[model samples]
Target: MTKESPLKTLIGLAQDDVDTAAQRLGRLQRERGEAEAQLQALITYRDEYHARFTESARAGMAAGSVRNFQAFIDTLDAAIGQQQRMLEQADARLEAAKPEWRRQKQKLGSYEVLQARSEATEARKSARREQRDADEHAARVLRMRASNP
Candidate 1:
């Protein structure tokens, strides 16, 4: 059995690492998107709630009710801020994974290039060996014919 090329093995391992990094990056991106969507939904709800409060105030809302709406809106704003921070963290992680993936991909490419060069070198050596053998056989045949004649 032919031995496996070490460079090929290194390439395979690097490819796997790159694939894993890509998957991680995809997950982080999805998480960031979900967080953004949630933040938007919360903002929308907060706007709609404030609009309702405004309408109620125009119609002369009770003092206690106005205080409660203000408190809840404050809480929503805090939650939105927290979600934004979470999304930022996720973005950072995804951004970090991108560089790791690129590095692995570059490593794999280098290994592939090395393997190609090695294969080409082996092919050239084999062709040279075959040509030398053919030449020797031809010389032997000519020598034999000349001696016989």
Candidate 2:
């Protein structure tokens, strides 16, 4: 088996880091999406409840019923505000994860570049050795011909 280059090992590790970062970024994005969906759902529910309350009031609701509706609507409004804050926090976390993932990707790319350059250098060296061997063999064959003749 060929010995592994140290650079190859470093590159592999860097790639793993990049993969981990990407996964984390994906998770963060999913969480952000979920939070946003929840926020939207809360907003929709609040709007629907408010509309129902308005309809009841127009249809001659009792004073007690109006107060109850107002109180419940106020509670829903508070919950919606809380959910909006949670969504904002999720967005912030997703934004923070993005730069770290990008940094990992850049690091992996740099390691890959080093590996490529190392391979190229080895190829050049091998080619030079092969050329030198061919030239020596040709000279030896000519010398033998001259001596035998």
**TM-score, structure 2 vs. true:** 0.94
* C-alpha-based local distance difference test score of model 2: 0.91
lDDT of each: 0.89, 0.91
Q: Tell me, by lDDT, which candidate is best.
A: 2
TM-score for each predicted model, relative to the true structure: 0.88, 0.94
Q: Please give the distance, in angstroms, between residue 138's alpha carbon in candidate 1 and its true position after superposition.
A: 2.6
Give a tens-digit lDDT track for model 2, residues 53-106.
888788898989988988998998899889889988998999999999999999
Span of ten consecutive residues with least summed lDDT in model 1? 3-12
Residue 119 alpha-carbon offset, candidate 2, angstroms: 0.5
How big is the positional error of residue 38 in model 2, measured in Å on the Cα after superposition?
A: 0.1
- Clashing residue pairs in all predictions, respectively, total 0, 0
Query: Best TM-score goes to which candidate?
Result: 2
Superposed model 1: Cα runs more than 4 Å off = none
